[model samples]
Target chain A: MTSRRAFLQRSGLIGLGFVAADALATSERLLAAVPGLDPGDPEVPNEEVARILKDLFGDRPIRKGHLTLDMPVVAEDGRIVPVIIESDLPMTPEHYVKAVHLIVDHNPDPHLAAYHLTPAIGSVAIQTRIKMKRTTWVRAIVDTSGGDVWAAYAHVNVSLNGCG
Target chain B: MAIGEARIRIPDRITRGDLITVNAIVMHPMDTGFFRTAEGKPIPAFFIRDVVVTYGGEQVARFEWTSGVSKDPVVSFTLKADKEAPLAITWTDTKGGVYRQTADIAFTAA
Candidate 1:
């Protein structure tokens, strides 16, 4: 005897709850990996990165925008495999790009590189070479207008890992 | 600057659908930690670990690497076709300094 309106409301509540749980899970996962990363450059904790990012913004995670990752799951040549990131969001001076972080999973330590972009960079695009330890996920987290964090994941299959 | 000779090869032109392979090599000593100086001092980590290449002022390729690359670093990638554009290469030192250079890829009948 539940009304359709009541069912819709319940479903909406469930959706909201799921989203909250998902966000929590993502943050936890990020934090969990923070300790093991002895990157040698500097042991940059995930929290410090979060803090830096928060200080830049109003203490909010970047918004998820329309983003695409261009890379193959398996690379024929590990020394250099092609990779690219393309965001569908409009690139303009008024509401333009901020930065892009490259997360290469195959490497012993992730958080491979960061590209600080401006309107002059045009569309916040970046391409780079990353040494893969094994089969790994390459993620591109982009910060754009509205403080959104749009990310795209790419699984790189490497037959010849450049790290070797 | 241990090696002076390097090679760069880019296909004629790139368009939306066309995929082209780009190749580059930089001559340098990829000194891994396995070696030591005459006094047995572990040479500080000095390697080109990061590389960025842009086309037509838009970034087209990038690389993250370590000293494991080899004595000399050679990087190659593929990209879609575009009009006449310049491919810029910037090699980043371990401590984060950049050695910037550019290459022009011309759109010609291939």
Candidate 2:
């Protein structure tokens, strides 16, 4: 066994050399008390995603450039995938955007995540991260004037996402 | 039910004419009611239903959604901006809960 002082330096956890050699045991106990974050599964498909848009914005045409989406081509860790969106329109009281909706197509509840904005916003840009259980697309649905809908999307490959 | 924190990050230096990138993150339980309790019972689904974004108090984006999202949702966007404003995001749940965050950064001029 290493000397008491040496043990502390070896185990980067800090504050233990003074305790009995069972320090390792104590560490386990401390760690166990900490709660873990577990985000559940992602199970959405592209087709279903389209249906969602159609159902939500009835008879509204979704234009192409009102929104833009950015996502990593591949996410090694399923718990966090980067996503971004931006829109071109004055966010003034008279002409600003109304809201931005974010959708992940592989989660158990594929219909997760949404945002609402008022004229307080001068631009239409937002960035966020999400979890993915499998390969999926991050879809953005935007609401413009005359009740028209515009969309943007990005495909992200999740290696093995799920509740941690 | 867990309270979640959402954060936004953006480029400090951006062209006065090009769009800038914005990144955001939220800390949430996204408790999909489908979950089972420790007692092996199904937990009711609870998650964010919609979100909106604004820059300089001007409306920019909005959406409506169901439970197809992963937990602790993170989203990103591109904004064509000038040097005077920041972006803000807000989320709402069907259960009457709200989550919001903001980011102040440089944006290209229109």
Candidate 3:
């Protein structure tokens, strides 16, 4: 019969193995979607952001107009920073916003979220809260069903680290 | 608040063709796994990864999120009052936890 201490040690090792495997799986999934993603590299956030944008928009030019990104100029608490995005662009059957991508330039994971929308949404107004690791630029990229992309960004000074 | 508990808010009065806003907040820790406890043990990452909004049996919006979302995440969006139907919001977490909330959009004659 196996000793109790030996069994506990073995189980702990197995648990650590599972945790490592789960982390690997997550990075693999992200790498598959964004080939340039290097989750471990500290200097890759900007590159990763650009790579993700390229992956989504290809060689299409991203216009700087039509999107309004609103967030606090200085976030006293980095853990919960409110963000609001509004666009004057029309939302009709023929012309509508297809997706809105949120990105934080310096976060460990720069790609915060991607919101896919339909014309039935009626407008391009969205509000959410995000965590910022440090002072960084928060970007809002809007893609229209017609293949055009508009981008805007807001600079936020974070007083505390939120990713811990 | 419980991990799966959610609160959704919508206008009580609605008219056909008028745009309405829906706001939802869910209780979640959104742990990023990068933090360590007092004993120096790493915290495991657990967060909601996907959220879907459907109206009248049709999908209107879908959100794919990472660990950067805040704890007790809140999301708001606008939708057209095209018909009187059930609006549903579904949240799916990384550990296979799925939480859902639905609210009926009853239209009042303009």
- Looking only at chain A, give the TM-score of model 3 against the true structure: 0.72
Local error of candidate 2 at residue B23 (angstroms): 9.1
Interface DockQ per candidate: 0.09, 0.26, 0.65
Per-model TM against the reference:
0.51, 0.53, 0.83
Model 1 agreement with the true structure over B19-103: per-residue lDDT tens digits: 4666777776655444578998887666777777777888654565666454566655445554567777778767665666667
How much does each candidate deviate at the interface, measured as C-alpha RMSD after superposition? 6.5, 4.9, 0.5
Which structure is stronger by DockQ: 1 or 3? Answer: 3
After superposition, the stretches of candidate 1 with alpha carbons farther than 4 Å from their true spots are A1-59, A62-65, B1-44, B49-92, B95-98, B102-110
What interface RMSD, in Å and to 1 decimal, does model 2 have? 4.9
Worst lDDT window (10 residues) for model 3 chain B? B101-110
Kindly give the stretch of ten consecutive residues in candidate 2 chain B with the minimal lDDT sum.
B61-70
lDDT of each: 0.60, 0.63, 0.88
| Per-residue C-alpha lDDT of model 3 across residues A1-164, encoded as one tens digit per residue | 99999999999999999999977776565445444323432222344876777778777666677999999999999899999999989999999999999989889998899999999999999999999999887879898989988888788999999998
Name the candidate that leads on TM-score.
Answer: 3
